[model samples]
Target chain A: MRNTIGEVAKKFNLNISTLRYYDKEGLIPNLEKNESGIRIFDEEAVSALIAIECLKKSGMSIKDIKTFIDWCQEGDETLKERLEMFLARREALQSQIKELESTLNYIEYKVEYYTKAVTDGTEKMVKETMSNPRLLNLQ
Target chain B: MRNTIGEVAKKFNLNISTLRYYDKEGLIPNLEKNESGIRIFDEEAVSALIAIECLKKSGMSIKDIKTFIDWCQEGDETLKERLEMFLARREALQSQIKELESTLNYIEYKVEYYTKAVTDGTEKMVKETMSNPRLLNLQ
Candidate 1:
């Protein structure tokens, strides 16, 4: 099943401009083109796009993603550097998860405080209970 | 000791313009000023700024943060609405954390793939071991 760039973009709910931009940015290198200059997304090209989505969601910048693509194109010699990059980004993502988990804890406090306030038809209980973090520590 | 906006901004490694923007946005509603109009941030004001930092880092928008602040100032009457807002954002944060965690998993796979590739001095080894997702499931 051959897929055109427009077809792949539609399937992924991505804008055509975004796919074109990714192609220009080297995130989609080795993209095949027909004699008529139509973009062709083979299985390998689709896999690359999926990898790009994973990296982008994990907060990698366009420049960094391009570096990764360059490494892939350059082949076996860059494996060590690629491993180092993955390990570094793994730590960054871990820290991000920790930060968001803590924010969840904070938001839990607000939810509890407001729930109590709504129950009493006033915020007095919430204010009185404010100093105690454990009151909202549902976990 | 009383602190100026610049001092507080420097403490947090934030730009002076950011603090001014927060003030203009009403995130710091009761900021005091000296006789000559130099903004003086007391301990309480500093705490407010810290709270703002927490919310901002958790992906809250300027408009939403302003709504939260307005709720605080509007007293007990806004408790229910505040509760709804907190619940909505709590769900949003939960989704964000889930997304990040999945990204971490994807990165873990990459790290494992590259680690083996580097050890074998070839990308062929990386490609062979790609089938079992559980092999790199560090979590």
Candidate 2:
């Protein structure tokens, strides 16, 4: 049996409004409407939604995702293009992971700095200071 | 000698507007203005900017960063709070990295799927199909 939009949203852990927005954006090409105009999701629609969510998580823009869906509709003819898109997204994700790791390193350093400051009962001795400490005193 | 806003922005790879916004947000507490009202960054201001940028990179919100700046102004009395903030930020960053890595894995799976499809000149055999293939035929 086909699932209602709400059912699909619950199954996928997505918001109903987000599913509606996807439909509005024409990303859910296989979505169907019943006699009373209620939205229904068949397997293909759900699969497409799964793919779209994955792409979005990979930081693909809506425009780019729309292009990917269009390519999916075009079938095997766009296989090369789809492959290239995934490759590019992988590179972007790698860069993001690297940058976040660097940020985490700095946060870790700060955590260590504060850990010592807390133990020492003052930041005066542990705090990093300007080369010309008088500049800090100036203001 | 104190550096002008533009000079500091160039050195730090930040936009002048962003530096001004930071000063406006009170993140750069020690920032000074010359007699002509031009912004000048002393060593203390530059150091605070560096810390603010690191916190921003770790995905701390502006309000949280403003609180941190206030805590810094309060000195050693807030060392424990600052430590807890960094600890929380580190956990958040770690979670983000894990999510991105998972996304990357799925993208890699798609890349492999497409690579084979491209080699075979068709997705018919390589494509993932719904258990009930008839659902795909419905739309």
Candidate 3:
């Protein structure tokens, strides 16, 4: 249930340097040191790393993740504040998703218009653009 | 109008090195050269940089953006293929948006659970966890 950093890196397909970077950033807590002064990780450490990866892929910054982990270690006393922080992050992500969706919709519309123009000929495309002032002078 | 790299960098709030980097990466094409071999950017170049910023924020890689620029320069002959590529990119972005949305939902759920636990006291929280067999073991 315990392993060296190298072992965990190999198992998780992460570079050893990334693990070291995370540790330096305070993203990992309760990291133990072996008799040889090497970092030792137990099952709980592995679970924490997995959680860190999840938060990272969800777009959480290392600083914010460090704060979240600190709250986790502090137990139920800080849970309400942690919950508010999590909800704020979730709302931010929701807005980001909405913005991306809107941009994607515009890109899709442009692609469709261009596709039709290429298939039906440039003359028709010009006429369509002329009829729709919004599509005028597209570069 | 024309501006030196330094002037452009100052006006745009970007570093001179970043402009050089963009030029080296082929993100900016056909940059005019002065008699002394210094780069000179016109209004169109500035507009292109703004467009590049828009695409970059939308998560498009510089290489893909270069290809898009190439297609734009080539005109209607490459229009169909360009449209197809844009459509494919749009789909990929839509999928990413969906993944972010799901992650946001999960975070929201966790936030609610933690908020209730923190407000209701740890004893009540432990009692609630007792309903779950895995958490019951901690009791």
Candidate 4:
């Protein structure tokens, strides 16, 4: 099925401008156009866009995504390279998850300390409770 | 020990411009100036900057970090609100992690499918594999 830009935008819950930007960025390849010069995207293009969105959220840059797509279109010769890219990204994502988990832990600790300080109603206790070498270094 | 912006930037492997930008953004609230009005950041400021870097990587925006700092300076009354904010961010980060995980799964599936197609060397199999229902919806 072919979809107009507006229809796709509504369906995907994306802005028209973002769709246009992606098209210009070569993130969406070979879009079909009507006689009036409007973009008419088919199901293949939509699928590719979905894949692009997935890669984007995984922190793959547009250039890297374009390279991946090129490899996809090129077939067997690039399969190993493509697999390596996926594995690398998976590792990166794992690291990011770990980092975020650590940050969450720090935030939780702060929240608990602050909560205690507020309930206890003593500035000295609050200072003592909140004061930490770690807190001093936090942004 | 006080450090020049250049020294601090090099120490942190950050651009000097980033320090200036952070100063302008009020991410570092207590930065001192030297005799020539040059920025002179103390150890405490460096620690704060490190924390800011951590928060930034965890997807906190400069404005949100500033709000957090404001709460920090406001004392006990803001503790509950601050804790709520951190909790909300934790939830958001969890959702973001889930989204990334889903994307990673999708990428892994694609990579595996492509690997199999490349190994089989059958155009028919490749075509059939590419016609996944997930890809269909995206189109």
Of models 2 and 3, which has the larger lDDT? 2
Please list the residue runs of candidate 3 whose C-alpha ends up more than 4 Å from where it truly belongs after superposition.
Answer: A1-7, A10-13, A37-40, A120-127, A130-139, B1-54, B123-139
Candidate 2 CAPRI-style tier: medium
Worst ten in a row by lDDT for model 3 chain A: A130-139
lDDT of 4 by residue, A20-67 (tens): 998887777778898989999897788878888878888999899989
TM-score of each: 0.90, 0.86, 0.69, 0.83
Q: In candidate 4, how many Å is residue A91 off?
A: 2.2
Number of the candidate with higher lDDT, 2 or 4: 2
lDDT of 3 by residue, A47-121 (tens): 778767657757888888999999888877886777788788877887888777766755666576777777775
Among all candidates shown, the one with the greatest lDDT:
2
Q: After superposition, how far is residue A127 of candidate 2 from its true place, in Å?
A: 1.6
- Which residue pairs of candidate 4 clash? A43-B139, A46-B138, A47-B138, A47-B139, A139-B51, A139-B52
Pairs clashing in candidate 3? none
Error of 2 at B134 (Å): 21
Candidates in descending TM-score order: 1, 2, 4, 3
* lDDT of predicted model 4: 0.77
Off by over 4 Å in 2: A128-139, B128-139
Instruction: Quote the positional error of residue A63 for candidate 4 in Å.
Output: 2.6
The best-first sequence of candidates by DockQ reads 1, 2, 4, 3
Fnat per model, in the order shown: 0.88, 0.91, 0.63, 0.47
lDDT of 2 by residue, A1-139 (tens): 5999889888778899999999999999968898999998987888888778778877889889999999988988999999999999999999989988877877777788888889989987676641223223212
On a 0 to 100 scale, what is the lDDT of residue A91 in model 4?
85
RMSD of each: 3.8, 5.8, 6.0, 3.4
| TM-scores (chain A) of the candidates | 0.90, 0.85, 0.75, 0.85
Q: What is the lDDT of residue B102 in candidate 3?
A: 64
